[model samples]
Target: MNSIGDNCTELKKKYDSCFNQWFSERFLKGDTDDSVCAPLFKIYQQCVKDAMKVQHIEFKEIEGDVLGSDKEQKVPPKSGSSSS
Candidate 1:
């Protein structure tokens, strides 16, 4: 049982180490119409929670009112925008 726990911890570390590049690759792709990105996002969220658990970090609820809740939902604009 101890060994399994240690292995899981190490794997989580490796996952974290490679996450930046993996995230960039996934996020940089254009229009993933095959609908694969959602699962990757979920896995990334779970991995973050797992790592936080391993590190004994406490989470707090967010306090801000949700932004643009009344607007019709659409994909967020890319980083460079021309809107003035």
Candidate 2:
């Protein structure tokens, strides 16, 4: 795998290990601040998005369904152009 793949994998692990667990615990504890939580959750979501974006992919998690939409969003390389 390339460096981008490695970074994406690491971030995905962090989201699964830390972010998701924290959100679950917080919501269960009845901390209902949708104002703050929504954006934070979105950031966590964007983290997942970003990590996937790193791997030249996109995904959306809507109402318990994870779907891969047709390549509307493009993931450009962090640097440089691809040689033919």
Candidate 3:
């Protein structure tokens, strides 16, 4: 997969590594502490946010306060209001 930020490919990879480890080692083990990958996630998120701005990607919040909550529900048909 490609990096979300143009210049932060390495940073993203580094963060991904940390995240995968955390998920398998801590989170799967019932550890909910987020301190392990907090710093790395911050850096990766900032880089991607900057890239999104540079690419003119309009960032908007979802009305239901959900991320990727059901693609069919989020996308409406041009003819009708079907939430299927």
* Global local distance difference test of model 1: 0.53
Model 1, residue pairs in steric clash: none
Which of candidates 1 and 3 reaches a greater lDDT?
A: 3
Q: Residue 34 error for model 3, in Å? A: 1.9
lDDT of 1 by residue, 22-82 (tens): 5566646753343444455456557656655787765552334557765445778889887
Instruction: Single out the weakest 10-residue window by summed lDDT for candidate 1.
Output: 1-10
lDDT by residue (tens digit), candidate 2, 1-82: 2223544555445545554565687757886543544444455566656666766664543233334656346666766777
Per-model TM values vs. the true structure: 0.32, 0.32, 0.66
TM-score computed on alpha carbons, candidate 1: 0.32
RMSD of 2: 13.7
Residue 4 lDDT, candidate 1, scale 0-100: 23
TM-score of predicted structure 2: 0.32
Least well predicted 10-residue stretch by lDDT in candidate 3: 61-70
Clashes of 3: 0
